[model samples]
Target: MAGMKKLLIALMMAVAAPTHAEVFAKGADIGWLPQMEATGYKFYDSDGKEEDCFRILKDHGINTIRLRTWVHPSNDRASGHNSKDETVAMALRAQRWGMRVMIDFHYSDSWADPQQQRKPAAWEGHDFPQLLDDVYNYTHEVMQALKQAGVTPEWVQVGNETRTGMIYPEGHTDNWPQLAQLINRGYDAIKAVSPSSKVVLHLDRGNDNAWFRTWFDNAQKYGAKYDVIGMSYYPFWLDGRPDYSESISDLGANLNDMAARYDKEVMVVEVGGVDTEPQNTYDMLLAVQRKVADVPGGKGLGVIYWEPQGARSWSHYELSAWGADGRPTKAMEAFRVKLGDK
Candidate 1:
């Protein structure tokens, strides 16, 4: 009788435990959407009918929206309009559309990437210690504002494409300890406000395993706290302008290796192909999605197309998936097919 009762209890406990549903995130970094709309750019569906950009993105099967926030952004058409207020508003809009949000903190007034990670002008005179405070305070403030607005981001990136490190000389990779300190500060602030949000440490060159290994090895040594590893894969920007075919497999290997090596989740936070070549871009997107989904233990989080809705004519960016007709090209369709679908 005692043994039968114990088995029954165990079965009841198992039945009561919640099951974890695996959701493969289909994301689009439409950070430029607000600026594009503000400047009178309209988005159309495949049928040539004008529609709200969010609706069109949903139709393309985008379940997550990524937005970038800049400190003291200028009013310039191209270089501006990602201020904190703008970010919060966009997050709210995304939530209304039933989409998950990813907050990308550029820590700059403009673009922050591998080529340049300039410090915001407000923190120009701060010493290293003060810089750490700046990161924590700014991150906490943004997170608090989002929380107050009932917007909880699914993922928060502490810095953009920091292969060389962010905040210039102070937080540069040359100074690993200081960079790690800065990253931890941001991480702490984010967790304090939104404990459930996963913090991402992002870098460019998703296909370069050696670079990722070295960089992440140093990050580990310095005790940087991050929940996910984010990467940017842009074959169009490669030195020889290689086709996606040349580097896609390498990207897949790197994603798998990062998950297994680091024991953490991995995501292709940014990826794009030539906008003019929609069919090729479509094929590349499908391949990239497959590579990410193939990560063992389901640690492959998601793939986000950077600025897919930012039509080339408006942004003058060749990597966008939208065309001059204000409609998303066939490449956007790649997102419509989710993982595990036939």
Candidate 2:
């Protein structure tokens, strides 16, 4: 009778426990960290104290680091900073700081974005079948390197901002079959290398729910097996400059819709400031936080600031909060301090 009573009591306690607690993503894309350090760029905290960038962000409650990788980048590219070895080194740093890592693979020698999904030069002559092989091999190699370096990424984006598709005209939206095959190949490689890593299908125009529905529906219909929906939200560039106040509501609704419709995780994988309006950025990000938090079952993963280390611009990203002094501007308060805090 005593053992039975104890067992029943323990079972009752377990049933009363919460199924899962929310895990909010407070993160930054410090992809430019290595290139900036090489060019004598330094980072300082608000107190004007010299500090490593990773330590500074972590102190501000950031829990994840996003890095980009490229295939045989050239000197003319955005400092050619996102090579496999470079990414491994950077991810290792994030791991040491106890931050989760998310690797964004552009898959091209240079930028692979919505507007231009240029294929890597090395893959120009290969057929579709061969290109698929290359993608699997490259992804596997990168994951292997990161694993060897003692850093396994929590998430891996097969292609960055791939609304129209990746690897150029060969795998563009116009060619859905080829694109789906390529995406799945990358997915298979991630599974083979690190089975725990979640795959993301990142695209631009995050606030526009209609676009997402169409894009994701098409992706699924064509066999794009993604574990997460990653979105890039830039106020200035999206919709020819959006009105932050009015659009934030739509952003929330869209986030909720995505979470419910996909039955998968959603994340604002990329967002940034347009002007130096720190308060506006703060307000916008706060809205994002609320929307993501409200997702049923906490499927809304988190937001990642695209190159938030705005102090140095090896890539010359205009949307940054870091000023000329290598210290973050008031704009960074969006991530550093809570909405109601000082």
Number of the top-ranking candidate, with lDDT as the measure: 1
lDDT of 2 at 78: 48
How good is model 2 by TM-score? 0.90
| Candidate 1 off by > 4 Å | 1-21
Task: List ranges where model 2 is wrong by over 4 Å.
Answer: 1-22, 312-315, 336-342
- Evaluated at residue 234, the lDDT of candidate 2 is 80
Across 50-163, the per-residue lDDT of candidate 1 in tens digits comes to 999999999999989999999999989889898999999999999999998999999998999988899999999999999999999999999999999999999999999999
Candidate 1 TM-score, true structure as reference = 0.94
Backbone clash total for model 2 is: 1
Provide TM-scores for the models: 0.94, 0.90
lDDT per residue for candidate 2 within 1-342, as digits (tens), equals 999999999999988875322457788998777877777788998889999988888877778899999989865434576889889998998989988899998998877787778888888999888999999999999999998998878899999998888997778989888999999999999989899889999988787889889888888799889899998888778665866666777777888888788788888888888536767777777777666767788788888888877553444667876766777766666665553443
In Å, residue 164's CA in model 1 sits off its true spot by: 0.8
Error of 2 at 154 (Å): 0.7
Clashing pairs in model 1, backbone N/Cα/C closer than 3 A = none
List clashing residue pairs in candidate 2: 117-168
